[model samples]
Target: MAVVDHAPGSGHRTAGDPGGPGPRGLGRIGAVPPRRRIDPADGLAAVTAWRTASDGSPPPRPVLATAVRWTLAELADRYPGGACEVRVPPFGVVQCIPGPRHTRGTPPNVVETDADTWLALATGRTTWADAVATGRVSASGERADLSGLLPLE
Candidate 1:
């Protein structure tokens, strides 16, 4: 799972766990803890917003961030256990699939792409083979191909 820094002094948030606590025990204080994972429903909302943008204009950073994070998190949530690491730079990374777990050094299975490509693939805007053929994605290891599980839309 991807690990990200949440609010200051708050505990780290793993990609698959959205209900984790926030800074200084905020959840214990009855405050809503910061979201660590993307809720599938919320992800759908983000996707809708993006798809409805006028003239193909890109949504704001927050919207894109939400969509990207949610999709990636949802992927992690669906595929429990760590066998492959998927990376969307400047947005998030998630460990998924089910097989031998990688602990250190270069992971055996890895998939990487820019945020746009990842979003496109996740939303069915592009195919895994097209992304790979066009050099928009870099995948390594036997289990790194996610064509079967893509278009999470």
Candidate 2:
């Protein structure tokens, strides 16, 4: 299973378990904390500013978080599948691409990266191949390549 900061707080203590690292340490077998719904429109403003900034600097934390989650949601909506799990820690995670869905344990296809890299990929600021070459992404499984569906601007 993926261990992401977006799942829950670091202290993963569960009732009836002392915590040893497993389902018990995770607070539940395969449960993730609910994500805070962010309106994409709100993020669009920040993204626009970020894209055109003279300094090429990122937006503030809240704004960046909004953008990351919105982009992840947009990707999920576009792909509409559970074959690949894309994760951006401290911000978002989404299941996308079309193929077989995993019912238990770690998914066969997974793509994990930081929010900055994800935003770059979601927008047209960077390419999948470039990010992969630069080691900005960790993609596993055949369906994890998202180049076809990116530049989602």
lDDT of each: 0.82, 0.81
Q: Root-mean-square deviation of each candidate, in angstroms? A: 9.3, 9.0
lDDT of 1 at 59: 86
Per-residue lDDT of 63-141 in model 2, one digit per residue for the tens?
7777788889889988899999999998878898888998678999999999888888988888999999999999999
- Count of backbone collisions in candidate 2: 0
Return the lDDT, model 1, position 126: 89
TM-score between candidate 2 and the true structure: 0.72
**Per-residue accuracy of model 1 over 107-132 as CA lDDT, tens digit each:** 99999998788888988888999999
Best by lDDT: 1
